[model samples]
Target: MGVVEADEADRPVSSIVLIEPANRADLPAIVSILARETLLGVRDSADPGAFPDYERAFEEIVADPRTTLYVARLEGQVVGTFQLIFFRALLRHGALLAHAEAVQVDPEVRGHGVGRAMMDFAIAEARRRGAGSLQLASNKQRLDAHRFYERAGFEKRLDGFKIDLSGH
Candidate 1:
């Protein structure tokens, strides 16, 4: 609800960390971390660059006021990143909607609450931007992530089906 602050004593071993928008300088690290996370536990995955081109994508997001990209920092090291995109519909009057995606966390800090802090920051930021609702679709295989979202007070809105529009 309120601001989440990382305690100084918890540094290294434990830290609360702060979440802020990703800058141009942080793109390389962000991309590298995402590549690693995406490849983990997969036997025959596609190329590492299969994910969104964070450098270019982030630039566009930064240029647009309707979108936000955030990175979680602890002890001056980025541990996680996520993005929030605000959408508006003319029929909905002044209501705003936010969609979150590309959530990735460093494996070394999995249980240290870095992910939770990032999600909380995203939620707060969305609310601050006057978003009437927030939505996120997690992959079905990410059961742990599903639990994490539920623990954060998000209820399952759908079974999260997908259609492969990427025709080869």
Candidate 2:
């Protein structure tokens, strides 16, 4: 909501971070951030040749009314991103569920409250959307991410599993 100030010892800087729905033009930066900042970079790429595929995927995601891809901008530069999906769940008496994925913040801005602000934005957005809960899964090997999520008030109540359909 306000400009986040980095610790003086870490980096004496402050800037307003705004999280909003991403546009087509933001895809390149978004892809670059994902590839450069996350462990999933092995599967994600920022190559110029990869733009076509990313563009197609972005089109489909934006077409869906229940889904939104968001970007966090710091001083007008793309610095972070996350995707949020809203769905109805039968388990919680037909409650609306918000699933957040692909959250990443540039390494250059780590520990500057960018991630925290992005997460806080996600939580607020979920609530504003009338979601009963906001849920996300972090890679088991991402211990730092786990700690960050915990600090954000998320609980480790269940284990998560996935099967790679790509069959790589």
Candidate 3:
């Protein structure tokens, strides 16, 4: 039930308004946004309902204690989505870290500050949860996204690696 209300009075156009936790009905829209991404498109299902595994994954995400999937609504349209996962660590003074993943903004509303708003909410949420740090990983090819994350006050300090078995 976490939500962030947007101030449309300060903007030229009032497209984005409410940001809330994504529910089952939002799966199609979320998948659509993911499908539009150049890097994730190959991994996300083309037809939103074609993947039953996604439904299972959603169910698992729901059962998890430290995970949240959020979608941004722009005038009743689901235009953006991101997932936040909190991690418990024995290091760093046993601090809990909030990790954001699979963030996507619809192409039709890319420049309307929707992505910025989502990141702001994520940071706020991490603060609310008392997480020691917030972090995320974006593909090296997504230079534009890297710039965006930087603008959101994220520093590229540590290097991350991943072994892709899916060949995406």
Which lDDT value does model 2 have at 119? 85
* Count of clashing residue pairs in every prediction: 2, 0, 0
Q: Backbone clash tally for model 1?
A: 2
Segments in model 3 whose C-alpha atoms lie over 4 Å from true places: 1-13, 39-41
lDDT of 3 by residue, 1-168 (tens): 444544464355544456788899998888878877876446666583676877888888888989988899877789898999999899898999999998889988876777888988999999999999999999888898999899889999988998879764
Kindly report the root-mean-square deviation of model 1 from the true structure over all alpha carbons.
Answer: 4.2
Instruction: Give the CA lDDT, 0 to 100, for residue 61 in model 2.
Output: 98
RMSD, one per candidate, in order: 4.2, 2.4, 2.4
lDDT of 1 by residue, 77-137 (tens): 8888888899886656867889898888888887677887877888887888888888899
- TM-scores of the candidates are 0.80, 0.90, 0.89
lDDT of 2 at 33: 87
Q: For candidate 1, list the clashing residue pairs, or say none.
A: 6-16, 10-14
Q: Residue 60 deviation, candidate 2, in Å?
A: 0.7
| lDDT (CA) per prediction | 0.76, 0.85, 0.83
How should the candidates be ordered by lDDT, best one leading?
2, 3, 1
